[model samples]
Target: MLASILMTVRKRRQPIIRLALSTMVAALLLGALACSPPEPVRIGFLGGLSGRVADLGIGGRNGAMLAVEMRNRQGGINGRPIELIAEDDRQDVEVAKQAAGRLLAQKPEVVIGPMTSAMALAILPQFNTAGVPLISPTVTTNALTGLDDQFFRVVAPTAAHVSKSAEYHFRENGLRRPVLVCDLRNKAYSESWAGDFRTAFERLGGEIIAEVGFESGQSLAALASSVLAEQPDGVVIIANSVDTALLVQQLRMRAADLRIATSEWAATERLLELGGRAVEGLVVAQYVDRGSTSPAYLAFLRAYRERFAHEPGFPGLTGFDATNVALDALAARSRGQTLKQALLTQASFAGAQSPIRFDAGGDTRRDTFLSVIRDGKFESLQ
Candidate 1:
């Protein structure tokens, strides 16, 4: 009888031990919950933040962070704060790829952009392979977006802009026997734009007198003199602002009868600032109005100035547009849509530059606006 009583006591002890252990585990879990911090959803900005294009990216990042901050102030998406991780591409393709890789390692919900067509093209294949969507701020080569199901952009295709410019200037303005000076060997955007200009001009019954390929380091004076000797009707330059401005100034000095037209890449304040009076009467083709009167553009311009203490250019606005779209996708992650899909859904976005809308093929086809420099500013050619 005594042994049976002892066995009963031991069984009671076993239950008490298990109950105490469960209580300790529950307390530990509660403690962990109290100490752990909520994870913020990481979004990556891939761009040339420190090189020649720093102005372009700084303004873009500023605009995007403003949007994110506004969203966060509203208590965030599903109680998760959005955080931005910016990586500098230095305007180089190899550097862009490395920057993208670093961003992907952070496992961002979406990647903003590499900013240059060449940079975007170099980094997209990796993101696509990983099923991560990339949204370009302004790299509009069309080849980047139309390549796969993963790439997208808020900026209208630079190629289409080039084509439209050629169409209007060659057909409407009667610019026959034009000189084509393109930055062929630098980036795909320029090369493609040059081709489009040639095709459109010839199709409109205009002749290309001389097709010249100038390197980034070539002297604008020499190039202008060489092209002027050909006695062309107009000058079509498919290059960046650095080269474009130099060429414009040289052409202004050499030829009074020559008309100058630059592509989307040359749409920067640097052109007007550097080219000075030479940029006057020069036509620039772009997807967005430089001096836009829309409320959205005005508001964005204000915000960008407040954040960065300066005005935004066309590239900066494209960055903001791309960022806002990507952020919208990220905030809506619970709805089973990706950054690419959200952008590609043909949703019209009132961007700082223009009303941005992208097709299913990741191409953004928008109306081109022709603007001319007047009084040191770009004015709509009404």
Candidate 2:
């Protein structure tokens, strides 16, 4: 009888011991987790990941992703891992606002991109209301410049690029009578660039014979005919790569020997792939120097190709530079200082090919290069 009683007591105690062990294990795990590290620092990315302009948006997103990946590989900002949340704006105003709203809801420290000026304008109000700064890689419309708002960009305004191209055409290329073609789809960028070019070109004693504006889905043949009818010596196209390439082909079909120049908005590799022989001899200005041999740029180029399996174009280079600017400010910010304040406080930040300095209004300027397509490649005119 005593043995039976003792056996029952042992079995009960066995279960209690097992329960204690399980509780202790769970407690130890919780303790370890608590002692590990803080939560990740969240960063939001917005761009047109789909649709016609996906090339620019994807490149910018990839560059931002690369920056985040590289930083996380090393000990992230102050030992906190960075979590990049990317959203596709779809290159539509409504979609961009929705994407921005979603990103803002996540409460990221900062958001990088909406690669074009139109998209930036669409979502700037949301970012401003959320108190999160929007740092763009390639939005160059002059509309956002000199604003004390939350918009900041790594590239200069439209005037910086188009004004230089105008001077180059007038003085270097000797194209006195030039016609302008604008893409109405991205009116913010296209119109801004065209207006600036007109101002500069006219100021240099060059005459603009005609100015034509059309949307992307319009007939290129009719557009080309309209542009050619002006009988101008030179033509400047302000559009995206796909549109630019198609229009160039149309123009080449009619005027093979006419001089053609394009704004930097169309200066992507897609333009070459799509334009082919038609794009040869087409002049353009770009913020990124493809022939750069700087150590920082070369290293970034290698890493980007290895990770993305493609070349990082102007969008990628500028996106990487923009992200680094935000990261630098985040790392150096005082306990209560805002990201904008932190950025403005710094004198300069390191860029892939050059140094980046932001003015009091969060605007930055970089070197622009004039290049012409030679044998299907952009060769610098410098």
Candidate 3:
């Protein structure tokens, strides 16, 4: 009788034991679910971060990074943090292709840059194949403009910037004859910019005396001499900041009073640092208005200075704006909505310095300002 009773008791405890085991498993799973972190939204950045154009790349990268950091602090997109992956294209076509391949492998929601027009053209095909959109901070070549492809830029096209500078040179600056020094390294941008400037300036009765083309490593002294051979009243330089600064220095050594201007591509903090007095009167168009008292711009300037310990310049400002546009679209996109579709759905986005609006072809325009380097600063040309 006692053995039977014991057996009955054991049978009753079986269900309890099973129930306890199931409960423990449920508790462990819940604990794990609570402890695990959420997935991050991946974003990619591509630029020539280690070459002659590194200043622009580094500035752009830092700006994107700062935007991601700030957004993550504010609870991120739908509670998921953002992860920015950066690649240096080294300003080489092969390197840019490899970098794009590496960035695409990670499956980013969007990419923020190629910095220059050449890099954009180099890696655009790969990004299109992967169905990823490239939101460039500074690639303004007309070749990419009005394309319904996977490319979009925050700044206007080459014509928008160069034409304005051309008009300013012809009508306002009273430069009747000018020579162009084109950098062949960035052939796409330099050529497009020079072509537009030529059209605009010539239409305005200004003459281009000569066009001197050179690669980056060529002798700036010889190039300067060639430019001086034309005996032009003014000079326009289309090159990177480093080369532009060196060429300006070379020209200054020969003709102290020659009026000089450069493409906005060469307008960076490095130009002032390297060119010093030579770039003092150098005129160029800028995407940002430095004299603005806008709260958004002031906040960005302060944050950028604090984060990077320096000025953000054009690249940084555009980088920040481009990344924010991506993030806004990412946050607002509905289920099953493509990133391109999401971007186009919005009427406009608020930029750090100004409002940004895109056309149906994913082309946007910013207010370009004509500024001259004065007292080691970019001052508005009144």
TM-scores of the candidates are 0.85, 0.92, 0.94
Give the lowest summed-lDDT range of ten residues in model 3. 284-293
Clashes of each: 0, 0, 0
**lDDT, each prediction:** 0.76, 0.91, 0.92
Identify the runs in model 3 with alpha carbons over 4 angstroms from their true place: 1-23
Model 2 lDDT per residue over 1-382, tens place: 9999999999999989999999999999999999998899999989888877988988999999999999999889999999999999987899899889889888999999989888998899998888898999999899998989988889999876677899999999989999999988789998899899999999999999988999877999999999999999989999889999999999999999999999988888889999999999999889899999999999999999999998788989988989988898999999989998998899999999998898988898877988999998999998
Question: What lDDT would candidate 2 get against the real structure?
Answer: 0.91
Q: In candidate 2, residue 17 scores what lDDT?
A: 100
Q: Give the deviation of candidate 3 from the true structure as CA RMSD.
A: 2.1
Alpha carbon deviation, residue 131, candidate 3 (Å):
0.6
RMSD of 2: 3.4
- Model 1 regions more than 4 Å off: 1-37, 171-174, 335-355
